[model samples]
Target: MKVLIPSFYLILFLLISNCSTNETVIEDVTEIESVYFPTVDGTNWETKSINSLNWNESQLQPLLDYLEEKNTKGFIVLHDGKIVIENYFNNHDIESNWYWASAGKTLTTAISGIAQHENLININNKVSDYLGTGWTSASIEKEQLITCENLLSMTTGLDDSIGDSVLPENLQYVTDAGERWAYHNVYVKMQDVITQASNQSWSNYFNTKLRDRIGMTGAWIPFSDLSVYWSNTRSMARFGLLMSANGKWETSQIIPENFINEATSTSQDINRAYGYLWWLNGKNTYHLPQSQLEFNGELIPNAPSDMFAALGKNDQKTYIVPSKKLVIVRMGEAADNSNFALSTFDNDLWEKINLLID
Candidate 1:
C-alpha cells in the first residue's frame, strides 16, 4: 500500500503539470493586446477604441481576425458613419486589387442610377430601345416591359438556364430575355445605353461625377479576373461608405435618396433576394415573394431580416444592416469548407466586438 501511494502521487503530479501547461485561462485570453481588424487596405489593422474594448485600429476578434490573417483578400468596416476597420493580407498592401465577383453588379446599379439622375434614360424604357431589335424574342409587350429597372431588380424573369452567358451583345448579350434569376451581366453591359444616352463612357461619367467628387483615388471602373480594370481595396471601401451614407459623398448628395432607396431595396422577380443587381434578406420588406428565390434555405443562415448584402463568389461580401447602422465588407477565399485555414479569425474578432458594445 505504501509503495502504491507514492506511485499514484507521482502520476497525479505529472497529470496536473501537463494540464497547467496546456490550459490557457480565459482572463489571460481576454487581455489580448490590441485587436487588428482586416480591411481592403491591404495591411494589418490600426487599432481604435470605442468604450470598454479596443477595436483593431481596424477590427479585432477571432473570426474576423482569422479571416483577415489567412486567405482574406481584404475587409472594411463602417460603423455609425466612419470607416473603423480596414485590413489586407499576404504582403498585399491596400494597393492589391481584388475581383468584386458578382458584387460588381452593385456598381452597375450605381451607374444606372446616375444615368437616371442625369435624365439620359428612364427605368421604364425597354432594353430593346437601347440594344435594338432581337435583344428579346418575347412578345412586343414583354419586350417593351424589359426596362432598365428589370435589369437592376433581376425581375425580367430571366432564369439561370438562359443565363447571362447566353444573353445577347457583341460576344455579350445572349438570346433569351425573360425567364429566371440568372446573372444579368448584360444589364450592366448596357452601360452602353447610359453612354449613348448621356454621351460618355461609363468610366468617364462615374469618375467625373462620383469618384473625383468624393475625393476617391482608387479605380472604380469595371474589372474582371481576366480584365485590366483592376480595383484596389480602398476604392471598394469608398463605395461601401457611399452606400452606407445613402449615396452621399462627403457632404454632397451625390446619390439621391429616392434612387438610393429604390436601388438598395428589393425587386419584383427574386425572393428574399434578387434586388436589381442587389440582394435582400427577404424577411419582411414587401419586395418579392420568399418562395421565388433560387436557394431553398434563407438568403443567409442567420442574417438579420433587415440585413442586405452585395455578395460575390468565393466569399466576397458587402453587408449592409441599416438597423445596426453598420456596413461590413469581407473579401476572402472560399470560406465555406476550409475551417483549418481561417475560421477562428472572424469568430474571435466578433467575440471582442460584443465586449466593446452592449
Candidate 2:
C-alpha cells in the first residue's frame, strides 16, 4: 500500500478548504453594532472603566454595600453606553430630585409613542375619542369600549380599586374592555389622552415630544391623584439612556423604532408582564397590582432576560437590558418591602445585581 500526496501538497489541501469555507461565510454575514447614543448636551455622558471591563473590582465594595443597605438614593449602572457605576446613598448626591412614582408610566409610554409618530395620536383610537363621551362611568356602550389600547394595556376593564382618580366617579366598570388585568390610576388618564389628542399641553406634550428632544430634564409635578415625574438621578440616567438606545438620540429617531418596539414588547394578553407602560422581563407569565394573581415566572427573576423596567412607587427604577447593554438606575426611599410597582425588593435588587454582573 503506497501513500502519494505532494503535488505541492495537492494545492495546499484545496487552499485550506477554501479558507475554512470563507470563514463561515464571513461569520454568517456579521451585524451586531448599533448601541452608543449619548449626546443629550447637558453633560456629555461617556465614562467606562471597570478596569476596562475585566471588571471584578472586588465586585465594587459589595455593590456599594448593597446599595447602602437598600435605602439607596441614587445608583446607576449603564454599560455599553458608558458609565460603569454611580452611587449616592443616604445623604444623596448627584443633584437629587427623584420621584418617578409609577416610573412615570414609562415616560408616558414614550410620550405616547411620540404622539403616534406625529400624526398626533391614535393608540387604536376611542378613549371616547380624546376625552369626550362622559369619560368613564362605563355605560355609553361601556364607554365606547375604552381604547388608547385599553389605556396602554392595563386592559381597561377599569377598577383597580378606584384609587388614582380619573374622576368620572373613579372610572368604574371592572370587566369589559379587554376582560381583566389591573394596574390602575387609569394610567393617569393617558395624560388627558395626550392632552386631548395633541392640542399640546401635557407639560407641552412632554416638553416638545419627549423632554426637549432628549435632553430630558423632567417635570410633571402635581402628585396626589397622580402626576409625578421629577428628575435628577442624571435625569433618570437620561431616561435609561433613551430606552437603552432603541428610542435613539445619537442618530435622532427619538422614540419610534416601531414605537420603542411596541413600547417594550408584549402590550397585552392579560399581562404577559406588560408593555406599552413597559415592565416586561422574559415573560412567561406575570400580573400584579392589586393582584388577581398569576405570577408564573420571569418578571425580574434576577434580571437580564432582556430586562425591561420602569418600576416605581418607592422602588423607582429604570433598567433597560438589551442583552446586557444594560441601563439601570435606582432612586431613593422605600425598598424594605415597597409596593405599587413591585417589590420583594425586586428579587432582592436582582440578587445584588447578580453579585455584581455574575
Candidate 3:
C-alpha cells in the first residue's frame, strides 16, 4: 500500500508539471509580435514573400484567379506594411493609372485634416466662411448653418436627387443642415472651400500637404464637375499603408493623429458605419449611398471587424485593417451592377481574402 501511494503521488506530480509547462509555451507563442512597419524613403518600398509569412500559397493563386475573373485591373495586399501580394489583370501593370472614383473622398478628407492642422482651414467653421454667402441655392440663413463638418459627414441637408455636380444650382437645400444625411455633390464644393480658404489651387494644396510628402503620384482630373483622383495601383497601396500607420510616413507625421482617429470613427449619429468619408466595419448600423434605408450590421461583414475602407464606383477600394496590420487596394470595373460605393463585391472580395489568409 505504501509503494502504491508513492506511485500515485509521482503520477500527480508529473501531470502538474506538464500542465504548467504547456501554459508557459502558450504564453510565449502569443507574445511574438505580428506587425512590421516598413522603411519609407522618397519612392523605395520593402516587400515580403507569402512563404515568409506562412500564408497559404495554394489559396493565394485561387484568389488571384478570382480577381482576374471578376475583371480586376489591379490588386494589392500589404501585410505588416510590406507588399505580400500584388497582381494585375487585363493587361494592366504597376505603371497603369486607375481612377479612384468616390474612393478619392477619403483623400479629400485626409487633405482637409492636413489643412486644418496648418490652421489654414477649420472643419467646424461655416462653409460660407470660405465660399461666401450665395454659394448655394439655399437662403443665406440656411446656408450659414452648413459647416465643413456637415459636408464631410454627408449631412449637408442638400437635395441629392439632382445630378452629382458641384454647380451652385445643384446644391439646393432640402432640409436644414444637421437635420438630414444625404450623399451628394456638396462634397466637391469642399474642394472649392479648401482652395479659397488656403489661397492655393486644389491640386497644389493636396500635393503640397499630402501627396508629395508621402511620395504618392496622382492627379485630380475634372470629370463632370467632380475632381476624381487617378494614380497607379501602387500609389493607392502606399496611401493605404500610410493610413494603416496612423497617418504617418516612416518617422514623420503626415496627418494629425487626432484627425486620423476621428476620420476612422463614426462621424455622425445617422450613419454608425461612416467616418468622415471612410466606411467603417463592425458597426451596429450603416447607411448606403443614394438610399435612406438603414442596414443592421457591419459594412463589410467578411472583413476584419476593425477594417475601414475607401470605396468607389465600380468596386475601386482601399481597405485599412489595423488589427491585422493589413492594407488592401483594388482597382477594377464593377464587380456587380450595384451602387456607386458599397456593394456585394466588398464582402465577396473580403471573403476570398479571409480564405487566403486562413
Candidate 4:
C-alpha cells in the first residue's frame, strides 16, 4: 500500500511539473506577441515611462544634448509600439513637418509589396511591363533585363552620377542590370509603376493603401523630379511601430509578413547591407551611396547586429531592431557636413543610445 501511494504522488508531481512548463512557454509567447497600436484618427498614442522599463535615466539628458548639438530636430524611441522617448530640439516642435529625404524609399518598398500581393504588380516583371518602353536610355534589351526587383535593390545599373532625376536622358545605362549596386533615385520609378498599375496617382494610392491605414499623416511633395515624403515626428514613429510589429497593425496585415522578411533581409549579393530600399546593419560587408567601395564590417558597428534602418540625406533615420523590439526615429538637418544616407553621426549617435538603453 505504501509503495503504491508513493508512485501515485510521483506521477502527480511529474504532471504538475509538465503543466508548469507549458504555462511558462505560453507566457513567453504572449509577451513576444504583445504590442500596442495607436489610434488611427486620434492623438492617443500610448507611452511607457523610462522608470517602467528600468532604463538608465541618467544617460537620457546626454543623449538629448548630443542630438541637439548635432542639429537633430526630432527624435523618438519606441519599445514594443509604446513611446519610450520623445524629444525635439533646434527650435523644432512635435507639430513641425520634416522631409524624409531618401528614407521615404522604404515607404515605396512597402507600397510595392502591397501592389504585388494584390496582383496589381509583380517584382519579377520588367519595369517596361507597367511603364512601357523607352523609360531609360538603355537599349530595349538592357532595359528589359531590369526588373522591378532591380529597382528595389538599387541594382538598376543606371548611371547614378547623372544626378537624382529619373528622366530617361539622365538614366543612362552603366552596366547590365544586377551587375552593381548604386544608390540612385531610379527607385522612384517603382512609385510610378505603382501609379501605372493601380490607375491612381502616387499620393492617392499611398494614402489609401498605407498612410491612411496606419494612421500616418504625410504627403509626397515634389522636389524637381523627386517626390519626397514629409510628416511630423509622431507620424514617423507610428510607421516605425507598424514595422516593428512585422508589418501589422492590430489584426490587419498591412504589409505581408513574408514580404517584410524579404525586404528586411539582404536583397542582393552586390550590397550586403541593403534590403529592399532599406539599409541593413550586421552585414559582413556593405556599399554606400554614390560610391562603389565596399566597406568591411557592419553598417553601424555600435547598433544591434539585427538592426535595419531607413537612412536618408541630411541624417533622417528610422532604425528598427527586431531582437530588441525597438523602433528609433530621427529627423532634421545634416548632423555634420551634409551627407547622403549614412555618416559618422550614426556610429556616434548609437554610442549615446547604448548608454541609455543598455
- TM-scores for the candidates: 0.69, 0.35, 0.89, 0.92
Of candidates 4 and 1, the better by lDDT: 4
Candidate 4: tens digits of C-alpha lDDT, residues 245-273: 88899999999999999999999998999
TM-score for candidate 1, residues paired by index? 0.69
Q: Model 3 reaches what TM-score against the true structure?
A: 0.89
Candidate 3 accuracy as lDDT: 0.86
lDDT tens digits, residues 153-185, model 1? 655654434433433422222233444444544
Ranking by TM-score: 4, 3, 1, 2
Weakest ten-residue segment in model 4 by summed lDDT: 24-33
lDDT of 3 by residue, 1-358 (tens): 1222356786686678787846422122124454444433435567889888777788988899899998899999998778888899999998899999999999989988888998888999999999889888999999999999999989999899888776888889888998887877688777888899888899998988888887788799988878899999988988898889888876788999999999999988898998899999999999888889998988888999999999999999999988878899999888868558988888998889988777
Tell me, by TM-score, which candidate is best: 4
Candidate 2 ranges beyond 4 A from true positions = 1-43, 52-105, 110-130, 134-141, 144-153, 157-179, 182-192, 201-204, 213-237, 241-276, 280-295, 300-356
Which stretches of candidate 3 lie above 4 Å from their native place?
1-43
Write down the lDDT of every candidate, Cα atoms only.
0.59, 0.81, 0.86, 0.91
TM-score of candidate 4 relative to the true fold = 0.92
**Largest lDDT belongs to which candidate?**
4
Give the worst 10-residue stretch by lDDT in candidate 3: 23-32
